[model samples]
Target: MDRGERFDRLRLARTERVGPVAFDQLVKRFGSAGAALEALPHLARRGGADGFSIPPEHTINAELEAGEALGARLLVLGDDGFPPQLAALDPPPPVLWTLGDPGLLSKNACAVVGARIASSAGLRFARGLAAELGQAGLTVTSGMARGIDGAAHEGALPTGTVAVLAGGIDDVYPPEHDNLWGRIREGGCIVSEQAPGVRAKAHDFPRRNRIISGLSRAVVVVEAELRSGSLITARLAAEQGREVLAVPGSPLEPRAKGTNDLIRQGAALCEGAEDVLRALAAPRTLREPDGRWDGAVPDDEVDAVRDRVLALLSPTAIPRDELARGVGAPAAVVFAALVELALAGEAELLPGGMVCRS
Candidate 1:
């Protein structure tokens, strides 16, 4: 893509109601970043708006400057060396702001995530597993939060690691990890989907967790509560057809329940790094088509479908299947509409296609 085209694509990405799915559909349908950029406002307006607003060119330029100031460049999803696993997600991040050695992402990766207030044992286990996994030539990936995530990065630092953050690459969420962030930028890498200057928010964490799992071959959940963010990453990994590994914890510990339940559901019980590597080495093909349409809904139909979907959804969580059935729309249309709603900040897409008004 040329410079103007690249900027146009970035503009599209930063536009209101334009997300990965819509972006991909636009690109695939239009056949170039240039075309997609030209088509974005038209699509948005067709979906029912007199006008559409994108991030100002000055803002995007400022973000680029900030990334450059930090010695980080923006890595678009389809760029050479972008993690294939991450790129394969239905709605992969459009661009990543990365610091340190981008080549670290080329190495095989295993994500290690858990509670921020993980148990001492869980921390130790994560550290040891990361150390061994690094020794085995695997790159560790995690959200660089406290406890398990911090330990995992520290353990893997000698070899390399990837820290996917909830904020900009230059913005460290947990203030305590400022020094740790510097270390990773020097010895490993830090990346983010949000633009520079974006502060970490609660909603950004799960989006960040998706990248943590999406970039890896497997996700290891060490100690996570039933509702922990780490378990969210584990679920995303499973849905992505990546191996799900759970390190057993004491049943009495509330944090362990998520992992234990995952094990009961057939996630591999991880005893050690060897178990993780073995699972990664196992022969498997998760690239099957699964019969899902890889196309986007026509622009003219986008808003009508979105409104129908909105009518069927409620504050109470409802299964997406039932919502689609109630709306009498194809599942793919519902999925695309949900993606649009999510981008527009009108709805939230939960795991398993469930959505609720934001």
Candidate 2:
């Protein structure tokens, strides 16, 4: 892509309501980001939006400048250094701000995640497992949180690790990990989907977790409570068809409950790094990429389909296939219409192929 086209893609991605899926649809439907930007207002209007505006060029420029100032660079999708594993995700981040060595993304990786207030034994196990995995030639990846995450990174730092941050690449959360964050920049990598300077929010953790799982060949749950974010990452790893490994913790420990439950449900039982390595050796089926639209729907036909799809939507999200059946439209056509609705802020595309009116 040329410089101008790259700028357009960045602008489209940062535009309100234009998420990863919407960005993909716009580019595929219009043949280029430049063309997509030109058609965005019309598409939004056709989907019942009162107004639509692309982000100003200066805003994108400022973001780029900030990343540069922080020693980070933007890795737009399709760029030379973008990780292929992450690209294989159903809807990967359109752009990622990256710091430190970009080359680490090419290596085989595993995620080690667990409770922030972990027991001493859990921390020791995580650290040893991480070091063992690192020595076994796998890059350890984790969110830069306290307890288990910190221990894992410290163990793997002598080799390599990747820290997927929930906040901006330059912003440090939890306040006390400043030294670890700096060491990660020197030894491994720091990455985020959000623009520089943005603070971490409560909702960003799940999104961050998906990227963590997406970038790895497998995810290991050291210790987690039922409601913990570590479980969320494990679930995402399963959804992404990556291997899920859980440490067998004591039944009396609260943090072990989630891992035990996962093992009971057939997640691979992890005793040490050897378990993870053995699981990685097993061949697993990978999900094929979703088929793309050929942009065959005529403008008038799209309008009709949009209306029909809208009629089936409510505050309650329904499966995309169910909406397609209700509207008597082809699934691809319904998806295209929903993309337009999503970009217009008239609908939401949830996880698991679900959709609902916004």
Candidate 3:
């Protein structure tokens, strides 16, 4: 939590090819980010990456300085200020930059997400639902997007709301939400996994959505198309063991397809705050991760297992256990090879212990 270790963690997270899963693995393997930094290059070489790079100390210093200049706080993984809900995730985010009251994240919260081009009725419903939930002492979390997402925050502003962004904490998307972004930064909270001054790409939204669900007790979907990003948030929420609720819409409405399907597949029906409340009262069902690859793999087994894991890997994601079965290696040694391959950029390390070719 001190300055030096914090700097090391930021640098490690910013390092190329190190996603959340690999980040957790490397830290657990070496015991700390500072020690992990020392071993990253050697590990990458074992995975067939010849020239891996770590961000320079000066670069991390500049990033920290930029965040400080904006009056933002950096909450790296393992920091006491990092929300316990997020830390409890299968592979928690390695870094989060916050621009307002970070305390709100630790409080009970629920996510209200939906389509950007939502119907007027849907937007109104989302706003009212958010206000009711906020009055019930739950912080409303959303992406600060237009339509349903924007409306939810407006209704919750007086109570409490947290906006998770795909870009930097200061990078306002939709260009028009400049005012909304400022209000959230001052009155509520603004959060992101990206560094300062970074603009968002299309791929970044999924990662941003992951944080929204991770920080929430449950995710409530409003109007969303069959393939909308809100559906993605609902899926991530379920995968993370958080309850999922959807506000049903008229069957004739195109936006209702996703939520209707979710309900069909067993998502709770959200008529109002009461429905969400009921789901919250139930005990959570997050499966404790078992058969973790915590210990080290001997150098002798590295090349063989790494090659086998690579051969079995394709674009199709497979659970680590299944990968282990295919490679015929102990789960520990197989995962160790995966960590290295992840760092080398040959394999992708996904949440829920799923991996595939990068």
Expressed as tens digits, the lDDT of each residue in 1-358 for candidate 2 is 7898888888988998888877777787788888988988888888778998888999999999999999997888878889988888777778899999988887899999999999999999999999999999999999999999999999999999999999999888778999999999999999999999999999889989989998999999999999899999998899889999999888988999999999998899999999999999999875655674335467777777888788789999887778888988776678878887987788997654678899
- Candidate 3 structure quality by residue, lDDT tens digits, 251-301: 999999999999999999999999999999999866555645666778788
Quote the lDDT for 34 in model 1: 74
Provide the lowest-lDDT 10-residue window in model 1.
Answer: 286-295
Measured against the true structure, the TM-scores of the candidates, in listed sequence, are 0.87, 0.96, 0.98
Best by TM-score: 3
Model 1 / residue 181 / CA error / Å = 0.9
Off by over 4 Å in 1: 287-358
* Candidate 3 deviant stretches above 4 angstroms: none
Tens digits of per-residue lDDT for model 1, 1-358: 4577677777777877665656665666567767766665655444444666767789879878888887887777667867777777766777888899988877789999898998889999999999999999999999999999999999999989999999888788689999999999999989998888789988888888888988899999998899888888988888778999998878888989999999999999999999998998887655432224345576456566878877777788877778878888777667666655655566665644456876
Best by lDDT: 3
Q: What lDDT is obtained when candidate 1 is compared to the true structure?
A: 0.80
Q: Provide the lDDT at 353 for model 1.
A: 45
Stretches of model 2 off by over 4 angstroms after superposition: 292-296
Model 3 residue 29 lDDT score: 77
